[model samples]
Target: MRDADTPRQEPTDDRSHPAALTPQQRADLIRAAAAEVRERVQAWRDNPNWRNTPANSHRYETTLGAIGVLSELPEPQTEEALASLADAVRPIVVEWRPSRPGPEQSIYAAVERLWRTIDVHT
Candidate 1:
């Protein structure tokens, strides 16, 4: 147990810190989320009902925006880049609701995963 006289010690490994992520980890996460979004987009593209609702259209646009941002992330990604991606997708993350329940949920969940990774590590 630490006592009042004892000094607080810092983590020796940066990865053990609350907000530290390796470059590979960040890039892998971005790639994974982008792939998931792509799959959802494909599924929705096959379903005319997915686009009938106005709310669904907005959500679809944001997911496409997420894909664009994710695609634009440069190699050897930085915290700033991940944070910017998070910022760009924040509205959709907060506002997500599928017109139907299948593919859109997957897209929302994929973006949520990206948000969690960035929020925790960036």
Candidate 2:
């Protein structure tokens, strides 16, 4: 028997989602990602065409998908999803290069830096 107003709860697998970590980890990820990207704003401004490159384009979209989930989901619980996202983005970031000026590389570099924190802490 259940109350009509009770929210439906899905059974969560134990291992697929690790035990929730401290919320500080979540805050740190968001902070680091923001700082990394913001610091490279000038580079992005200088080489606006980097977005057109295939590697950068793919990297950018993958990063956004990770961030989308991170931003939308609750913290601690978001850790597993974040780790999966980081793992997926790693290869792309590793292979990415600047198609424009060297400064343009900072965009993906920033992304890599952000992803590292997620990798290291998790």
TM-scores for candidates 1 onward, in order: 0.62, 0.46
- Runs in model 2 deviating more than 4 A are 1-21, 38-48, 77-101
The lDDT for every candidate, in the order shown, is 0.62, 0.52
**lDDT for each residue of candidate 2 in 1-122, tens digit (9 for 90 to 100):** 66999775634434322224454554555455645654464455446464566755665555455455545544334556555545544544554454454655566666565554555644
Whose TM-score is greatest here? 1
Q: What are the root-mean-square deviations of the candidates from the true structure over C-alphas?
A: 9.9, 15.6
What are the per-residue Cα lDDT tens digits for candidate 1 across 6-36? 8776334334433555666666665676666
Model 1 segments more than 4 A misplaced: 1-20, 97-100
Q: Taking the candidates one at a time, how many backbone clashes does each contain?
A: 0, 0
Which candidate gets the maximum lDDT versus the true structure?
A: 1
